[model samples]
Target: MKWWLIIILSLSIAFLGCEKTDKPTINEDGTKDNGKLESGGKNPKSKTGVWLTDWNDAMKTADVLNRPVFVDFTGSDWCIWCQKLEEEVFGKGEFLEYAKKNLVLLKVDFPRDIEQSEELQKFNEQKMKEYEIEGFPTIVLVNSKGEEIARTGYRPGGAKEYVKHLQELLQPKE
Candidate 1:
């Protein structure tokens, strides 16, 4: 009886130690979220060239700059392809420079373990349905009026090649 009790207690302790933790995911962009109802970004236009998390802000900036909005819908934490897109293209200096000049960048992240506010959550959900996003790493280009111009996903090659592809997509159709 004593041996059985000891085994059970030891197993319980091990199981409790193995339980997952609810720690905040520190993003590459320097924002943190604990995985419920806090906004996912620093603020509206926190950094001039950084990606905006709010759609309205993105559109407003795009209109002011006369630039197209580059909306990246991604599962930032869990999606392999999304991470690849970030590493290969979005994180590169060349893309960042081009984006600052000609694009209002927006990041709509659906993280598996990050917290966002209720309003932000609703807004993201609405846009997800509105844009008919069917997968992770969906890159949608839209005009200042929020009309979708073109949509793309992960493409092979690095930042230069991806930038060239984006330039082609952003070209005005005759």
Candidate 2:
């Protein structure tokens, strides 16, 4: 009886630890530490519609293209909202075309299942600290020098509306 209860409790705790499948949790410092991210490296001109996970590479691409960097800080594998945003906005043709023309896309992710290189994990953790990331799916727009110009998160809308929202955010405020 007592042994059975203890065993069940332990199993529950084990299952609940790390990357909550039912709910999203943030650390005391407001950083997301769940899910996983995969690398998607490709040439900007290829127009294959993917993101670069390397920070330095993204900056270089932005410089070469004279464009801002769209940095997506996400828990790509576990964050439900992140997945929805990708499906409803990022993966669509409207945003893809807009992004291809105007931005160098970068993905910095905190994942659970996948094994990120130690260097990559360190670099990404440092970036989270530098950016003061609050939660999964935080998006920051930056210039070629990698200075942030604007920030936003998951918003309700499809790709076309999302493009409009981005256009508004990109507009110069006088």
For lDDT, the strongest prediction is: 1
Error of 2 at 106 (Å): 0.4
lDDT of 2 by residue, 1-174 (tens): 999999999998888765446343564436453432223433335422459898988886677667888999999999999999999999999999888778888999898887899999999999999999989899999997878899998999799999999999999989
As a TM-score, model 1 comes out at 0.72
Tens-place lDDT digits, model 1, residues 3-22: 99999999999999789897
Q: Estimate each model's TM-score.
A: 0.72, 0.73
Candidate models: Cα lDDT each? 0.84, 0.82
Distance from true location, Cα of 16 in model 2, Å: 63
| Candidate 1 Cα misplacement greater than 4 A, ranges | 1-48
